[model samples]
Target: MMKEKGLLIVLSGPSGVGKGTVRKELFSQPDITFEYSISMTTRVPREGEVDGVDYFFKSREEFEKLIEQDRLLEYAEFVGNYYGTPVDYVRDTINDGRDVFLEIEVQGARQIRDKFPEGLFIFLAPPSLSELENRLIHRGTESSHVIANRVETAKKELEMMNLYDYVVENDQVKKASERIKAIVVAEHLRRERVEARYKKMLEVK
Candidate 1:
């Protein structure tokens, strides 16, 4: 039997939505088999963030050079920093039959959609716009003005929810993670994903 290519699962949403939180929760599960695709970034690493493990930290010049070479699967500029996925790593890993998960912004997710239409795209949505704003404010990492700007940008990003294959509301971190896992399981069982393998099995007999 031929090795089946792995699934590319993208989790994205508007700014201030709990995408990272939900992704972290999902990976914490013992039975999770997906490989987390480490994204490359030009942003300064936060405290205790290891290079290559948390992100492939690069200089702006180096990141731009990769962009010019088309070596990135998807990339976007956020807060004056470049964040992107490495194309070769993702391709090779998926070809090896290990599902890859990407937690990224909506803009980067859109780029993935254009390049990998068959990939599973999950949109993490807030319970309400007000709730999203509250979450952003509670984070307290950004100034009030920055938070306001993010809220505005989130409004526009929310409109792009139609581009995703599934919408998981981040009302609660654990519940959202559970819903995402269920979606992945369902995607694997999708007829198109498995029919070809079954057909080949019957033909062999």
Candidate 2:
């Protein structure tokens, strides 16, 4: 039997676009190929965050060593802290016939696209800027000033939507989730990805 080729799915969007909520629903469906990548970080563990669950929680020195050794597919410095995606885990998981999903900002997505041109890019866009701003305000979890900053950044991020391979409008939860599921299923049957596998499976020696 031919093994399934793994996919690198990149999810990128501004905050309050409902990417998290929609992705949660899709991952819960269990009808598609998706894996949450555990990112490694040098930041201190936040409240209720397990050592290896929310993040790898590595020491700054260790993270730098990995960067020096070129063991990271991508790494970034945010607010004086370091975070990165380990290359080995991604390579191994893909070789095992499973798809890997990366949840990152637009910058990270761009970097990955530059390296892996064939990777799938999906952007989750809010129904409207007003609705997205409302979500930020209604969230009520962050300070007004912080929310404003996030909204400002979100507006800037929206400009990059044209660079994505797929744009998923997250207006209605059910409809958006269905759209994402269909996108995954369709990509799985992409000629290059499935053609070789089917050929191997049908080959008679």
Candidate 3:
């Protein structure tokens, strides 16, 4: 049987919507096979963040050079730092028949949509704004002021959820992960992806 092309799955959502948690759980499933796309950034590495594993950190000059050379699939500036996906890495992995998952924010997801319209875009959503605020506060990683800022940003970003192909509410981590996994399975079984494979067999017959 001919192999189908790999899927490019983009996960996007507002800040503190449990996207990272969902992604973590999704990959833990034994049947799910995918590669995580490591993003390149011009920001300083946080404590304990490894160079290539956590992120591929680059200097501003190097990042700008990449932009000029069209090496990035999509890029954006946040908090005065540049973050982008390296085009070659993603392309290579997908071409090798491995699904690639990009956990990104809304703007970066939109850019990916433009570049790869056929990609599967899933939006993660909090159950409610109040719940989202509570989770952010409970984490205690940020001050109240930062939590407030994140809440506001989340509200604005949530408005764009309609743009995604699927919206999964993160009421529970495992449930959300299951829903997303189902979507991935469904996408792989799409007619367009399977039609060519069937045609090749029929031609042999």
Candidate 4:
């Protein structure tokens, strides 16, 4: 039997859209074995963020060197912070026939979508701006100014939803997670690509 091909799934969403919760759900059932592609960033790790787990934290100089060496598969600057996807990890995972998941912002998503046109992309969206605001406020992780800015930014992000291959409304965690998982399962069963290859074997001798 031929080895399975790899899938590169790009996860994009606004800041307060509960993308992380849905991602946790997507990985919970163990049906899909995907490596969480670790992103390299110049930004300092947040409180409780672990090295190599939350992100591949690097010094600004080191990140610049990587950029200069063309070692990044996709990289973008957001609000004065640098974020990049290392090519080696992604390349290795894909070669191993394991799907890789990239959780990035809209700009990075656009870059990836353009580079790999066939890559599967899903955008998580809040049910409404009000609900998004409520969730952000309740998180209690940011100050009023940051919260206000996030809300304003989310409006712009939502406007770009059409660019994604799939838009998942992330309101109730359980429902949204199932919807995302359904996409993966359905993709596995899609008949267009693999069917043709299997046809030769199944044909009459």
Model 1 spans with C-alpha error above 4 angstroms:
129-158, 203-205
User: Ten-residue segment with the worst summed lDDT in candidate 4?
Assistant: 196-205
Query: What's the lDDT of the predicted structure labeled candidate 4?
Result: 0.80
Encode model 2's per-residue lDDT on 1-205: one tens digit a residue. 3677688887878766776677667777767567877788998898888877667999999999999999988888889898788889888888788888777767677777888777789988777665667776589667778777767867675777877999888788778888877877899988977887877888833
Candidate 2: where are CA atoms >4 Å away? 129-158, 172-174, 200-204
The lDDT of each candidate is 0.89, 0.79, 0.87, 0.80
Q: TM-scores of the models, in the given order?
A: 0.84, 0.77, 0.81, 0.78
lDDT of 3 by residue, 57-116 (tens): 999999999999999999999999999999999999888788999998789999999999
Candidate 1, number of clashes: 0
Better of 2 and 4 by TM-score: 4
Error of 1 at 77 (Å): 1.0
How do all the candidates rank in terms of lDDT, highest first?
1, 3, 4, 2
Clashes of each: 0, 0, 0, 0
Instruction: Sort all candidates by TM-score, best to worst.
Output: 1, 3, 4, 2
lDDT score at residue 12, model 2, on the 0-100 scale: 75
- Candidate 3 has a TM-score of 0.81
